[model samples]
Target: MRYLPLEEITEDMCLARPIFNGDGRVLLSNGVKLSKNYVSRLKEMGYQNLYVYRVGEEISDFSTPISDQTMREAIHGVKDAFGKAAQRQQLNIRDVNEIVSYILDEILTNPNVLYNLMDIKNHDNYYYHHSVNVCIISTLIAKEMGLAREKVKDLTTGALLHDLGMVCVDPRILSQPRKLTEDEMATVREHTNYGFQLLRSERNLSILVAHTAYQHHERMDGSGYPKGLVGEDIHLFGRIVAVADSYETMTSGRVYRKAMWSHEAIRQLRESAPEKYDPDVVAAMERSIAFYPVGSVVVLNTHEEAVVVDVNAKKITIQFSSGPRVNALMDLEPDSEIKIEERLS
Candidate 1:
């Protein structure tokens, strides 16, 4: 399956993966042939890219660190938990814990998998999807850093609910397409305190979990919000979530900005490391994320355009787009002189 920008998707290209709505219902099922109308509609809905089967190529499901069902359940659990909290009802800590546990198990099972944040997102439920993405990425970073299993669980739980305080903010303010006023920005920053109070009140949750919500915004150089804490003042869990949260936020489409490419996001993180982010945590994140995700179209130093088929392969697999080697598969050796120049999409 090739991941292509919506603008490049033409009629009759079959979808290789299902697209889900905010409620987790399938908007378009796998193997559905795309038409011009379907493509237009999807673009209108803010979908940036899609997974489609390359001509005459049939394959089994594309592998992910966690299954689609698990992602849907996690989104549902986060949405439901936020809803309950918004209504002043008890948050479903057990449901959230179960979702995190399942995610942790999947990551542990595939310890060597480099996570690709390529899931199609629905704009209406950005928070739910963002929460899950941060949790998954945080878990991967934790595992890569060799944190203990129990600590990983705590980090996962904290990362999953890091934005729980946003439930208290007005939805309109959160979705505003324009720059937030200084007053409006203050209200949004208060979410950390709001979330911390809410999580701390839960008898079953750890204090560290509550701190994750409070400190994910705090930076290493004492420039972050809610608190200007420098390095070490931020808890380990908080520092870890901060990296995951920032990376996910930057790479995710938001009301005010478009999503960034993974490589671009990584570059920004590296540029700001040990200042706005913990250098160690950022390094762990780099080890866990796929800079060149599968299904991406990239340009090689040899001036050949190829589509990445598998990043996890011992030698990465690339299919040349055209020329004498058109449609030919080549293994990109780790130390080869030929290198990827840039990604086209």
Candidate 2:
């Protein structure tokens, strides 16, 4: 199975895996043969890419740190939680805790797996999807940093609800496809304080969680919003969530722009490290996500094309060429000249 841009999809291909809506409903089933009409409709609906297999090609098993069952439940839980928060109603802290526990367990079990943020998004529920993706990425980074399990859980909770203030913003403004005026930008920026207030008001929640929502937008150089705090003045949880939130948002498609490739996003984070984001946190994030994720096609230094089947130790497992004679390259010699030259979606 390979990921292809919408323009590359043809009637000769088939869906290698199912696509789901934000509510967990399957929009397209696995193994469905593609047609010109289906491709056009998907494009009309804002789909950027798809996982496809050429006719007669084998479908590989897709795996992630979390299970499908847990993902569905978490999505439903986040949707409900967001709705109540938007209405200023009392939130069920116990329910939220249970959801966080499930996610933490999954991350702990697959400590080595790179978190994939590609499949969890859809146009209908951007907020909920973004929330879950942030939580997943943040938890992975926390674990990579060797934080205590308690700290991991705390970070997970903070990441899950980091964008709570967006609920108070006008949906029209939040989804606006054009640049915002200064007044409109100010209104949007208030989400940090709005979220901090809501989280702080809950007696059952920790003050640290409130700070997470507060400082996730802060920068290391005092250029961030709300408080514009500088350096270590920001809480560690906040710093961690800031990296996760930024990486997730950069790699995700938004109303104003297309999603970035993982390598490009990582490069941006590295470039801003120590000045904007904490250098350590940026390094942890890079270690926690695959630069060449599974199913990505690439051109190699050997002038051959390959598909990435797995990733380990900053290197990828590849199957070269597109012919039926498949050979897996598990590891490169220390002096091997072969390297990934480019990523082709």
Candidate 3:
């Protein structure tokens, strides 16, 4: 299967994976042959990419960090909880905890897998999807940093609701396709305080979890918002979440800006670390994510095009867009001279 942009997808391509709605229902099942109408409708629905099988290619399951069913359920839970919170109702803490536990369990079951952020995105459910992505990334980072199991669970929970304050902000500002004014930007930044208050008010939740919402925007050099606490002043959970949150947000598409590629997003994070983000937390994140996810098309230093087949082994299948195509598998080891020059998509 190949991951291609929606604009690049053509008619008669078989969908390699299922497309689910915001409510966890399958909108298009796997192996469905896409027609002109299917592609146009998907684009109209704001889908950016699709996983399609190539000609004569065998269908194989493309695994995610967590299963699609679990991801859909988590997103649904987040949407439900945030909608209730937006209505000034108390958040269902038990439901939120269960969602976090399920995500943690899935990650813990295979802690060594490099997380691939391949989930499809839609503008309508951006916040909910972003929340779940942050939670999964934060959980992986926490485990890689060797946090206690219980602490990992707490971090996962906090990461899941880090953006709860967004519900209090004006939706017009968030969905607008233009730059925000100074006042509007300030209003957006206030979500930290708003989320902190909401989370802190829950008696059954830990104060540290609330801090994750409050301090995730705080920078290592005291340049962040809500509060300008310097390094070590921010709680460990906050620091961990700060990195995860930034990575997830940068790699996700928004109404105002296009999404950054995973490798470029990681580069920005690494470049800003020790000043804008925690160096140790960034390091942990670097180890947990796959810079080049499976099914990604990349250019080799030798000027050949190939598709990534296995992220763990850095294995790729050589192919081309034109001329005689060759199918060969090669591992890109650390010591190997053959290196990935750039990601095409």
Task: Give me the candidate number with maximum lDDT.
Answer: 1
Model number with the top TM-score: 1
Rank order (by TM-score, best first): 1, 3, 2
Give the lowest summed-lDDT range of ten residues in model 3: 313-322
lDDT of 2 by residue, 1-345 (tens): 677777898899998767766675677888889899988888777677788888997645545767877777777778877788988997789988998999999888774578753663556777777888888889888888999888787789889999998889988887676679899999999999999999999888888888998999999999998999999999988999999899888887754687888899999999998999999999999889888777788887766778877664445567775444345554443355788889887
Ranking by lDDT: 1, 3, 2
Error of 1 at 19 (Å): 1.6
Candidate 2 achieves a global lDDT of 0.81
Model 1's alpha-carbon lDDT is 0.84
* lDDT string, candidate 3, 99-212, tens digits: 888898888777457677466777777788888889999998988898877888878988999999999999998877677999999999999999999889888898888888
Mark the regions of model 1 whose C-alpha exceeds 4 Å error after superposition. 59-62, 313-315
- Worst 10 contiguous positions by lDDT, candidate 1: 54-63
TM for candidate 2 is: 0.92
Off by over 4 Å in 2: 312-315, 322-337
lDDT of 3: 0.82
